[model samples]
Target: MSEKRKLAFSKANYLIMIAGIIVLAIGFIIMTLDSEPYGFGFLGLTLGPIVVMLGFAIEFVAIFYKPKSKSDTE
Candidate 1:
């Protein structure tokens, strides 16, 4: 008898990963929008990097996230 194969990540996890990627994109965009001649402004030097790091953190969470199963609640 053959059994169905399961995917590595759940739908929620994939959604979270997508969100993370979007956040990363937003951070990069913010950096590019900085008015400083060489991107030395606050957005380029601080906020943008912080947002990008947050995005990476979100991705890390998504990669390790596991939904609770009915059996696990017992």
Candidate 2:
């Protein structure tokens, strides 16, 4: 008899999730780089939010992405 096995997500999925988290961290760091008072400079006011949103988008994609099975590809 063979034992049945399954995983919630693949290694690739976790790698993507890690990348997204790294992106999010970079976005926050970019915001902190702003020299303006209260972080009102272009990085904080515009680039930061955009980057954060992109990070979130990446996270969303990573969470939903499904890798094709070896059999499927064949």
Worst 10 residues of 2 by lDDT: 1-10
Query: How would you encode candidate 2's per-residue C-alpha lDDT over 1-74 as one tens digit per residue?
Result: 59868678888899999999999999999999999999999999999989999999999999999999889987
Candidate with the greatest TM-score versus the true structure: 1
1-74 per-residue lDDT for model 1 (tens digits): 49988899999899999999999999999999999989999999999999999999999999999988899989
Global lDDT scores for all candidate models? 0.95, 0.93
The TM-score measured for candidate 2 stands at 0.88
Q: How accurate is candidate 1 locally (lDDT)?
A: 0.95
Q: How close to the true structure is residue 21 of candidate 2, measured as C-alpha lDDT?
A: 94
